[model samples]
Target: MLDFRMDTFLAVCQYMNYTRAAEALNITQPAVSQHIRWLEEQYEAPLFTYANKRLSLTREGELLRSMALTVKHDEQMLRRRLHDPGPGAHRLVFGVTPTVGMSLIPEPLARYHRLYPDAPISIRVSNTESLCAALDQGELDFAIVEGYFCKSDYDSLLYRREPYLAVCGAEYQFEREPKVLSDLLGETLVVREPGSGNREIIRRALSRENRAVEDFRSVIQVSDMNVLKKLLLLGCGVGFLYQAAAQPQLGQGLLRAIPLEDFQESHDITFLWRKGSVFAQRYRQLFELLSPQDIEGESCAAGD
Candidate 1:
C-alpha cells in the first residue's frame, strides 16, 4: 500500500496544475497546495516551479513522478492479485513485440492451447519498450522481448538469436553482388517506426560501418510489417527484417534475401518475468511448451 500523499503528488505531476489536480482528487485547491508543500518539506526540495503562468516539474519532481508511477502500478498489481487470485481460471497474459508476435509466438501458442485446452491465453503486442515497461509494472505475467541483454532484477532466459537479412522483391535488380553494406546506400529502404528495437539495431549496424540510413536515396517508415512486406514484394524498396520473418516469403519466390559480406551479428530474444513470482513456475511450463524443439521440430517432422 502506498501513501495517499504519493497519489496526490502523482496527480499534480500529471496535470501540472494545482486547480486541475485538486478537482481530479475532489479536494480543495488549498489542500492540494498543502500536500505539495508537505511533500517538499519532507524531501527538502521543491517539486515544481512556475514561470510566466506555466507550470513545470523541477528535476526532483520528474524523478519523484517516475518513482511514484512505478510504486502505484506495483500497488495496483498487488491489490488485484490479492482480490483475484486468477488460479484455476486458466488464463495467462503474455506480452510480446510485433516481430516476435509475427514470427515466433503463434506456433508455441497453438501448442500450448492444444496441451491445455482449458487455459485461455491473452496476448498483448506492442513495441519492445512498452512491453518491457508493462512487465516491470507487473501488468504482464511474462513477456518475450528482443534486445534485452543486460541482467535486471527480473528472471529471464535467452530463447533465440534472430539473424537479420536485407530483403527485396524478387524482380528487383542490383548493380552490385550484395557483398558489402555500402552497396545499400542508393536503394530505397523501408524501416519500422522509431523507438523500435528493430530500428535501433538497424541504426547501430549502419553507424558502426561509418554509414547512415539518411545517405539512402529514399527512406519509408511504416508501423505495419505486413504493409512493408507488400511494398517489398511490389519492388518498391528494400527492407531489413529478421530471417525467420522473411523465410516464408523467400521460399515463395516473393522476395530475395541479399547476403551482406561479413555481417553475422544477431539480436537476442528473451523471456522475462517478475523475480520470485509463483507465476514464474507456470511461465516456465509455458516456455517449455513453446520451445523450438518441442513445438517447431515436431510440427516440421509431422509436415515432412
Candidate 2:
C-alpha cells in the first residue's frame, strides 16, 4: 500500500496546484509543501517546476508518478486477487476509446465473457485522454486506445490497423472531383471534441497535408459520436473518422468516402497497460483470448 506522503504527492500530480492539492487532501497548504519537500529529499530529485507561471512535472516527477501509479495498481490488484473466489483470478478493469468502442471490441468482448463466465469484467468507454488519466490513477487495468500517448510509459500491443476515412453525406455534392485535402477546406469541418482519438487522428492527417483543422471554412465540435454522424448525414459538414464508425452509413448508401489523391492510409488501434505491470502476462493472455483474428499482420508488439 502507498504511504501518506505518496498520497499527498499524487494529489499534487492530479491538480498541479499546491493549494488545490491541499484542499483536495483536506490538509493545510504548508502541510502539502512539507510533504512534497520530504518526497524531494527522499528521492534526491526535484519533482516539479514552474514554467510560464504554470506548475508542471519535472522529468523526475513524471518518473515518480509513473512508478507510484504502477505500485498502486499492483497493491490494489494483490488484495483483490487474495479475496477472489476463483483460482488465477484476473481483476479486469479495462478502458477503450470511443472509436474502438463503437465497432471493433463488442463482439470479441462478448466471446470472452462466454468463455470466462466467472470473470467480473468492467468496461469503461471514454475518450482517449480520460482513459489514459484513469489508467495513471490505477483505475484501469488495461486499455485499448487509438490516440497518441507517451509510449515509454506503457507496454503496448499492435491489435490491428483500421482504415481512416474522410467522409461526407452521399447527397452532399462537391463542386469538383475533390482530389486533395485543400479542395475540401471550403466545407465546414465536423470533428469530435478536443482530446478525442478521432479528432487527434484528424489533426495528424491534416498536418500531413500542410493544413490544420482551423483552415476549414467553419468548424462544428460534437462530443457525441452519434450526433457527429447525424450532422454529417444532414450535410452539415464533412467528417473525418474511422471507417468502422462510418461503416453502417456507408453500407446503407447514406454516406460516401471522399476520394483523395493517393491517400490510402490506415491507423493503429493498440492495446496498452502500464509498463512493468505485475499483471503483464495476464493482460497479454487476455488479449490473446479477446483479439479478433480476422484482421491480419499486426499481432506483434511494438514500443510505439
Candidate 3:
C-alpha cells in the first residue's frame, strides 16, 4: 500500500487548496495540514507555499507530484494485473476529440474491429483537455487528440497532419486576394468553444500576430464540427475546419475552402498511450491501421 500521507499530498496538489483537499478526502482541515507537515518533515523541505490565501507548489512539490502520479499508475497496474481475469477477454477504451472522432476514427476503428472481433471497444468523445486528463487518470487505453503533443511519460506518434482551411458557404464573396487575417475581422466567425484543441490552435496563431479571438466578430460558438459544417452550408457564417472534414461539403458546392495567405498550416493529430501500458501492442496495431499511408490508400483516399 502507498503511504497515506503521500495520498493526501497528491490530493492537495490537485486541488491546490488544503481546505478543499480535506473536503474531497472527507477529512478535517487540520488533518490535511498535519499530513503536509508530516510529509515535509520526512522530506526535509517545504512542499508548498501559501500567500495571500493562494497556494502554489514549490519546486520540490512539483517533482513530488510527478513522482506521485507515477506511483499511482504503477499501483493501479499492479492491482489490475492481480485482479484481471487471465486470458479471457479485454476491453479497450479510446478517447478522442469531436473533430477527429468525426473525420478520422471511423475507418481505422472499423478495421480494428474486423481484425480483433473478440476485443470489446469503448470510446469517449470529449475536448482535448478532457481527453488528456482521461489519459493521465488511466481511464483510457489510448487517445487521439489534435493540436497538442503528449507528455514525456507517454508514447505519442503523429498519426495525421491535415490542413486547416477557412470554410464558408459557396455564395460568400470576397475581394480579389483579400488579406486572410485582416478581412476575417469583419466577417461573422463561427468557432468552437474554448478548451477545444482547434480553438487553442487558432488562439496560439492569432496570439503570434498580437491579436485575440475577441478581435473577431464571432456569430456562433459551436461544440461539434459537423454542426458547424451544417451551419456553414446554410450560409450562416464562415469558420475554420480541417480540409478532410470539409471535403464532402466542398464537393457538393455547399461550402468553399477559402485560400488563406498566412493561415495555411496543418494541425497535427497525435496518437497517445500511457508509458509501459499493457495495451501498448493493441494501440500500436490500431495506429498502424490509422497511419496516413494506409488511410489515404483506403476508402477515404479521394477525401484526403
TM-score, cand. 1: 0.73
257 Cα displacement, candidate 3 (Å): 0.7
Residue 193: error of model 3 in Å?
1.2
Name the lDDT of candidate 2: 0.85
* Local accuracy of candidate 1 as per-residue lDDT tens digits, 14-103: 688999999999999999888889999999999999999999989998777666655555554456556543565446677887788898
TM per prediction: 0.73, 0.91, 0.85
Find the 10 residues in a row with the least total lDDT in model 3. 295-304
**Candidate No. with top lDDT:** 2
Q: Write one digit per residue (lDDT tens) for candidate 2, span 99-184.
A: 77878888898898778778788899888888888887778888998888888778888877889898999899877768887888
State each model's CA lDDT, in order: 0.75, 0.85, 0.75
Please give the distance, in angstroms, between residue 22's alpha carbon in candidate 3 and its true position after superposition.
0.9
Clash count per candidate: 0, 0, 0
TM-score, ranked from best to worst: 2, 3, 1
